[model samples]
Structure formats: structure tokens, C-alpha cells
Target: MIEPPRFFSAADASIAVSHLFVRPDMLITLGFYKRKPGLSREQFSQHWREVRGPLIASNPILSKYLTRYVQHHCVPSNGWPNVGDLEYDGFSESWFDSLEARKEMHALPYFQSEMIADEHRFLDMKATRILMFDNQVVQVGRDYSAEIAAGKA
Candidate 1:
């Protein structure tokens, strides 16, 4: 049996809101991936949270184009009924205005060199996958479908 209470750790608090001003132009990108071979989850998450995330944010290329950037540090989703192993170790979520702006960042030498080099340290690029899309938020809160059905909106 899984003992979640014994091992569970929580993330720090965060706040988020969606504004219509950014809705039309903002593009959201998700990079799903696994850690490099031989690295522990602690090692991966520390380097990513402490080193890699800061590195990306500090760069002029990314900083200018990116409005928000977030890293997801995966924890074992044990204790959920019928759950299987997680497919990837963690993922990155980034928000920017346009693909053209993103492409401009990608074209920079700093991105091609420094950023890619840093990612090599802890990410398994071969196993990485990307998803790019815009949000069409029906809701962004705890599920309240039952309440909504009863006209709580």
C-alpha cells in the first residue's frame, strides 16, 4: 500500500489569472520530457528549478518574448486508484505573444548555443516532446460542474 502521508511534499503557493487583453495573441507552449540517464529526480528538479529555469529567464532573448515561464517538477502520483507510472519526468510551460516572436528567440545564437547546451545537462532531448496551443478556458478552477449545472456561474 502507498503511504502518501509519509512522503508527500507540497509546492509553494501560486496565483494566476487570465485577462482578455492577452487572449487573442498569447501562445502557450508545453515541453514534456524526461530527465537524462543516471540522474535522480532530486538532482534533476534542483538543477532545473535552481539553475536551468533561471538561466532561461535571465537570457535577453527569452526574457523579451516570454511573459511567463513555469517548470513542473513531477512527483510520483501514487495512491490514485488504477494509476500507472507517469510517462514523463516533468514539463515546462511558457507563454508568449506570437510564434513570430518565439521564432525570433529561437533564431538567436544564445538560444541555439547556451540554452541548448544547458538543456543537455539534465534533459533527455531524444525523449522530449512539445505541444503548442492557445487556451480556450471553459473554466480554470476546481471542478464545479455540478454547481454550474445548478446555475452557480
Candidate 2:
């Protein structure tokens, strides 16, 4: 089971609060993938964005069930810490109105076969990971240091 984030009272350090609220009606799936062997990261990202993204967006059934879709491409940076040899090429997020909608979408033969087949072209299926959750936005800004320092956030 997925554990909810823990909340604590500022006045009492020992006090623990639970905020387990989630949008059960909606389902958001995040898919992380590493490019298939022998394929350059550029090739993988381009194919996903140019070909796969358009294909999914144009699908009538998929477009109907999917509420939102986003692609996150990883960029190499020297400042970031390197953890072992494992590297992720990118990730994609798909949001559905409900879990039932997602189930109905997958039940379609086109989604079950064609979509899966297309995914294999650029993605290393064995190295992919998928997580389902409801997204919660806490903050959105460039500067939150002041608020954090004052304990207002």
C-alpha cells in the first residue's frame, strides 16, 4: 500500500497528523522509462514526442478517456549527483477521469495490442516503472524561501 505523507504540528514536535485524502475517482499514472539498448537518448525522446505522443493524442478512445498527458524529458547535467550506473531517460504522465475509464480504455484491443507494440520500439520494457496516484499541488513559484523561513508554509 502507498503511505500518505506525514504532517506534524509546529508547536508540538511529538504530535503527528495524518492527511490521507486522495481523489479516488481520478487515476494518474506516471511511467518512467530507460531507452532501449543501442538507441540514443535523442532518438528515443524524439520518437516518443513526435510519433507516440501524436498517435495517442489522435486516438478517439484514448483522447476521450485521458484527461491530461505530459512528457518529461531528462537532460544531462553535471551539477546533479550521480547515483550508481542506473539512469532514467525520461517519464510520461497520463491522467484519467476515473479508474473505470482507464480499465475500459485498456479493454480495447487497439490499446492492448497496438499501443503496447508501439511502446516497445523506444522503451526498454524491463526497465520501465509505473506508479498510480492522485497529484496534489502544494506550491508553484520561484521563491518560497521567505515563506519557509517564517514557517508560514
Candidate 3:
């Protein structure tokens, strides 16, 4: 079994409960980004979290299709194994009802012209990678298992 992380703040635990269940057909993508050469990590993270996040959320076309969005900023870890030397500055996750919804969202002219253009402001486009997945929530707090199993999660 995969052990849960040893530490979580009260706020984090609450958020964890909200995501205890996963939609098997949900289209989820993890977008890893490298900071632009001249930008510091803080600068890149701020722009993504403050500017880009609000921009995407405010866009009518883009917001309608998104089910969930999260930004994960990377922090240095001590004593961690390093293999390839490749490191991502941060990652953003976006979810949709299906893969087709993602395709349709991108097919919009505004997404191609505005969204892609905005990304270039802080991301090293050449170093970015996007991985898609169907999410599965394997475990949650012990008290919530019955609720989740009852389809109320």
C-alpha cells in the first residue's frame, strides 16, 4: 500500500476530503513547466498563479469546460534521489469531463491565440511537458470510505 504523506495542515486535509472521489472518465492533464531563462522561480510562479490563473478563470470559453484546476509549485527536497537532473519548476493540473472537451477547448480561436500567447510570458515553452491521465482516488480518510463507496463522494 502507498503510505499517505506524514504531514498535512488542517486546510490541506479539508481539501483532500473534497477530492476523495474521482470520475473514472475525467480527462486530467498535468502540465509541467520550466521557468523562462530570465525569470526567477518566484516570478514564474507568481505570474502563473496570479495572472494566468485569473485570466483562464475569467475567460468564458475556457472556464465553462474546466471541472477543476490546481497549481503545484515545486520546492527543493533534501536527501532525495536525483537521477536525470531534469527538474520542473512547477506543474498545473486541469480537468475536464472528457478528452473531447479538452480538444474542443483548444480548438477555440481564443485559446490558440490568447491562451497560448499568455503562456509564453513565463514558461519556457520548449521545456514544457503535458501528460494526460484518467484519475483514480485510491484512498481517503478512514471515516469517509463508506460515504465514498456509497457514491456520495
The residue-by-residue lDDT of candidate 1 on 39-117, one tens digit each, is 9999989999988988887776678988888898888878787888668889888887776767787888888988889
TM-scores for every candidate against the unseen true structure? 0.74, 0.70, 0.74
Compare the candidates by lDDT and give the number of the best one. Answer: 3
For model 3, which pairs clash?
Answer: none
TM-score, candidate number 2:
0.70
The better candidate by TM-score, 1 or 2, is 1
- The reply for model 3, stretches above 4 Å from the true place, is 1-19, 78-86, 142-153
C-alpha lDDT of residue 131 in model 1: 71
- lDDT accuracy of residue 83 in candidate 2: 43
Query: What are the Cα lDDT values of the candidates?
Result: 0.73, 0.73, 0.75
Positional deviation of residue 79's Cα in model 3 after best superposition, in angstroms: 8.2
